[model samples]
Target chain A: MHISEGVLSGPVLVSGMILAAAGTTVGLKRLDYDKVPRAGILSAAFFVASLIHVPVGPSSVHLILNGIVGLLLGWGAFPALLVALILQALFFQFGGLTTLGVNTVIMAAPAIICYSLFGRAVHGATRKAFAAAFACGFLAVFFSALLAALSLIGTEEKFFKVSVLLLTAHLPVMIIEGIVTAFCVAFLKKVQPGMFARPGMTDPVRGEKGGGK
Target chain B: MTIMTRRMNRPKFRVARMRRVGPVGFVLLLSASLVLISGVPAALAHRVNVFAWVQGKRVHVQAAFSGGKKVRNGTVRVYDSKGALVTEGTTNVKGEFSFGLRHKEPLRVVVLAGAGHRGEWTLSREELSEEPETPASHSPGGASTDTSPVPGKSSPEAVLSREELRLAVEKALDRKLKPFYTLLADSLNRRPSVPEILGGIGYIIGLVGLATYLRYRKEGKEARPE
Candidate 1:
C-alpha cells in the first residue's frame, strides 16, 4: 500500500528519500548484466501486481508481490521496486512524486527482509517451499503495513494504538498475497527453476556454481 | 493441492497439476489481472482526493480515490486561510459533505480517509459571493448569511431583479452541473491508461536493455559466462 504524499512529516519524507537513494545505489551496483532482464520483468510484475485486486475479498486491497521480487532479486529489489513506484506515481497517481521514496521503502524493505529470512528455504521440499512462499508473501505485506503505520507515527497520532487498526485493514491483502506467492513459486519451480538462484547469480539446484544448498 | 504434486515426478502428475493451477494457473491469473487492470480498475488504497467549491448557499465537498471509489465516511475538516479549523463534519455514503458559506476569505477543506490518507481543496472568497450579495452593504456576513430566497422576498426594499436573476440562474446551473463535479474529479485523478501502462513497461524493458548492454561492454563482450 502507498502512503500518499502530504500525509508524512517533513523529516520522515527526507529520511525515506535518503534510505531509498542508498538502497537503489546498492541495488544497481549488485545488478549484473544477465540479471537485468529478470529485474525488468519483475519490475513490470510489481507495477502490475498492485493493480490486481483480490477478487475473493470484500475489503478490496491489491497484491504487492514484493516477496517474489526479493526471492528472485536480493538487494536488487530496491531499484526494481523504485522504478515501478515511479511509474505508478506518474501514471496511476497511486503515490505522488513527493512520497515516492517512502512508498518504495515500504514495498522494498519487506522484500529484502523476507528474502533474507526464507531465500534458501524455497529450494527445499515441495511442502516446505510452499510454506516458505506463503510466509514470504504474507509477511512482505505485513511488514509493509507495519512500516506504513510506523511512518504515520511521525504525525504523532498515537502510533502504537492506531497501528493495529491499520493492520486489520491489511489482513485480507496478506492472505491473498500468500496464496498468490505460493502458486507463483510452484509454477516457477517447474517452468524456471534457475530463476531462484542465490546471490552472485549462482545456481543452487544444479550446484554448478553455487555449490549446493 | 496442485503445489504438492507440482514437483518433478511422474509426467502424469505434472500434466495433471499443469491442468490445474500450475504454469497454466499463472497464465490464467495473468489474463484475469490484465482484464481487471485494463479499465475501470477498482480498489485504490491510500489515494484519497478532495474537491470542494462554493455551490449556492453551501460549500459542497467531494472525496474520492484514484480508482473512482468514493471515500466513504471520511472526516471533513474546514479551515480558513490561516489553517485554523472553522468547522468539521463527516462525509455521507456518497463521500460528500456541505457547510454553510460562512467565511469571507479563502477556505480549505481537508478530507481524512483514515490510514494516513488525506486530501484538500480550497475555495476563494470571491467565488462565495458570486451568487448574490445583499445590496447597499458590503458586509460579507450580510451577503453569505442571508442567501435564502424567503428573506429576499420578505424584504421588499432590499430585493433587486439582477440579484434574483443571478440566484435563479445559479441554482439552475448548480443542479445541471452536479454530475460534472464527479467527472472533474475523475479526470483529475484518473488511473493509468493501457498505453501509459504499456509505456511504463516499455521504459523498464529499455532500461533493462541499456543496463545489459553497458554491463556487457564492461565485461569485454564475453559470452555472458552462461
Candidate 2:
C-alpha cells in the first residue's frame, strides 16, 4: 500500500525521511556481504510482486511479500524494500518521490518488526515454522496497514475514516500473504534450508542443527 | 556404485522431486488461483488518478482508479496557489467535478477516493487562461460592424452584443479544444505498460547490484591483510 504525494504534511515527510535514513543505515550494517544476493533477489521479488494485483472486495490489492523478505533477510528488508519503492515511484508513480520516505517506512518498519518477532522461529520444524511464517506474513501486513493509517492520521484528522477503510480492506491481503508465506517457507526449508539459519553462521548441511529455535 | 552412492542419490532424488512438486507446483497453483480469483468482473486495483483542465470559466476534473473505474462520490477539493481552499465539492457518479474558477492564480485539485487513496492535478495559470495574448479584434470575427439586428433574417451570432460574441467565441474555442482535453486525460490516466514494469524491475536490480558491489569491495578490503 503506497501513500501518494501531497497527502502528507511537511513535518511528517521530513520526519519520515529522517527515520528512514536511520533505518537504512542499520539495515545496511546488518546486511552482510554474503547476503547481498539474497537481498537483491528479495528486492526484485518485491518489485514484481506489487504489480500482481489480487482483486478483493471493492478494491484490489497487490502482493507485498515483505513478510517473506523479513523472514529471510531480517533487517535487510529495509534497503530491499526501499529499492523497490524507488523503482515503483520512478516508473509507475505508484507513490510519489516526495512521499517515498513515508511509504518506505510504512512498509519496511513492519517487515523489520516481523523479522525480530519470527525470524528465528521460521527455522523450526514444519508445523511450527509454517505457523510462524504465517504469523510473519499476516502481522507484517497488519502492522504496515496500521502504520499507513497512522501516517495518514498524522496528516489530517479527516483521514480517520479513510484509515479505517484501508485497514479493513487489507484484511484479505493479510490472509493471502499468510498462506503464501507459509508455502514459501516450506519450500525454502526443503530446497535451501540454510536460508533460515541465523545470520553469521555457516550453512547447515542436512542432519546438523538444522532446526533453529 | 557402493552404498554411499545409493544413499546420496536417494536424498538428491528426493530433493529434485520435491523441488518440482513443491515450489514450482506451488507457484503454478498460486497462479491458477490468482487467475480464478481475478475472473470476477469487478476486479480492479484502486489507485486514484485525477486529471483536470480549464473549460471556459470553470475547472473540470475527472477522477478514477488505475483500471479506469470511476471513483464515484469522492470529495474534490481545489486549493489556490496560496494554499488556501478555493472550493470543495463531491464528484458525480461519472467521477467528474467542476467548479467556477474563483482565483487568478494557479490551482491544485485533489480527489479523495476514500480508503486512503488520493489523486491530485494542478492547473497552472498559463494553462487556465481562456484568451491568448493577441487581441480578439485581430481574429476573423473580431470586427463587428453591424450595430443592429437584421429583422426576419437574424442569425444568433449576428444578434449578440460584443461581449456576448466574445463569450460565444470562447465557448466555440472550448468546443474545438475538446479533443485535446480528452487526449490530456487519456495520457494522464494511461497505465504502466509491460516494458515499464520490466524497466522498473531492472532499475531495482541495478541499484541492488550497485549496493552489493560496494559492500563486496568494502568487505574484501577488510578481509585482506595490509
Candidate 3:
C-alpha cells in the first residue's frame, strides 16, 4: 500500500527515506552486476504484476510479487523494488515522493521474509514446493497488510478496526496472489530449474513433507 | 480591460458585432465572443505554487497551480538553521528545482512558493532526514541571531515578503552542485514512461521464452547423452 505525502510527518518520511538508503546500500553490496539486467526484467514484472487488478470489498487489490522478487534476487530485490517504486511515485503518484521509503520497507519486508524462508522449500517437491510458495506469497501480502494497518494503528484506536479493514480489503487479492505464486513456482520447476540452484536462494531448505500444503 | 487591450493587437482573422446579429446568429455570436473574451483574463489570473521537499542540501520541488496553469518560474533557498541567507536562483520550467550542501551536514530551507507568492515554512534538514538526528545549531549563521519579531514584518517562520521569499527559494535552488543534480537527472532519465511499458512487457515475454527454450535445449542435450 502506498502512503501519500503529508500523511506521515516529515520526520517519519525522512527517517524512512534514510532507512531505505541504508537498506538499498546493503542490498547493493551483495549484488552481482551480471544479473542486473535480469533483476531489472523481474522488477519490471513486479511493477506490471500489480496492474492486474481484482476488486475486493470497496477497493481494488492487486498482486505484490515482492516475495517472488525476493525469492529470485534476494537482497537485490531491495534496490530493484526501490527503483520500481520511485518510478511508480513519479508516474502515478501512487505514493508521495516523501513517503517512498516507508512504502518500500512495508512492501519489501515481506519479500525478504518469503525469499529467506520459503523460496527454496518451494523448489524441493512439486506439491510441497507449490504449497509453500503459496503460503509465502499469502504471508508476505498479509504482513504488508498488517504493517499498513499498524501504520494507522496509533491514529485509530483498537488494532481490530484497522486489521479488519485491511484483511477484508486484501483477502481476495491474497488468495489470487497465492495461487499465482504457486503456479509460477511450478512453472519455474519445469523450466529454469537452475533458478533454484542460486546460492542463498532460500534459507536452509525446509523438509518436503513438513512444508505448507 | 488593460489585459484585453494588449491581446487585441496580436491579430484577429474574424470579428463580428454581436448586437447586430439575428436571434439565431446571436447565440452563436454570443458563444464565440465569450470564448474569445474568456481567454486572456484566465491567463492573467494564473500563478504557480511550488511545494519543495528538502533533504539536507538535496531538494525536490513540485509545482502545481489553480486552473491547470503551469509554473513559469520559481526557486529554493537554504539557510543554516540560523536566519542568515545561504544561497538562491530561478527554476527550470518543469517547476522542478534542486540545491546541494558542501558539508553534507543538515540545514534549514525557506522555500519561496513562487514568483509573486509569499513564503511559507522554515523547513529544516531534520525534516528531510531518513532518520532522526540531534539538531546542531539554531541561528541565521552569520546574521544576527535576532529571534526578535519585527512589529510590521512577520518572523521568517511565520512568512516573508513575496519577493524576499522568491529570492530565498532561488538561492536554495541554484546552490545545488552539478554532480548531485546530474545523478538525479540520470535517475529521472531512466524513469519509466508509457513507452517503457513495451519494454516491461518484452522483458516478461523474453523471460518466459528464454526459460522455455532453455528447458527444451536441456532436454535435447540429455537425450543426446543417452
The best candidate in terms of TM-score: 1
Task: Please tell me which model should have the higher DockQ, number 1 or number 3.
Answer: 1
Question: Taking the tens digit of each residue's C-alpha lDDT, what string does model 2 give over A63-148?
Answer: 78889888777777888888888888887778778888888898899988887788788878899999999999999998888888
Q: Candidates' TM-scores? A: 0.81, 0.78, 0.48
- Give lDDT tens digits, candidate 3, residues A108-205: 87787787788568768789988887887788888888876666554345677767777877786687667666765665555444444244533222
Give the residue spans of candidate 2 off by over 4 A.
A158-160, A197-213, B1-12, B16-47, B102-105, B131-184, B215-226
Across B1-226, the per-residue lDDT of candidate 3 in tens digits comes to: 9889768944441222221222234224323433443343221111123455554445665443322233335455656655566667655666466665444335554433321122223445455553222222322431233334455544655433433554466557656644565455333322234566565556545654665676678889999977
lDDT of 1 by residue, B1-226 (tens): 7776665457877655654454345546654644654354465655677888767768889987656577778889998889899999999888889888764778888888776677888887777766445434544345455556555454533445545665678789999888887678667666557898888889898988888788768777576674
Ranking by TM-score: 1, 2, 3
Candidate 1 i-RMS: 4.4
Ranking of all candidate structures by their lDDT, best first:
1, 2, 3
lDDT (Cα, tens digit) per residue for candidate 1, span A24-140: 998888776667777888898888777766432222467788988898888889999999999888877777898888988999999999988888888789899999999998999
* Two-way TM-score contest, 1 vs 2, winner: 1
For model 1 the local lDDT of residue A153 reads 89
Which scores higher on lDDT, 2 or 3?
Answer: 2
True lDDT of residue A63, candidate 3: 61
Q: Could you tell me the TM-score of candidate 3? A: 0.48
Task: Please list, in the order the candidates appear, how each scores on TM-score for chain B only.
Answer: 0.66, 0.65, 0.32
Model 1 DockQ class: acceptable
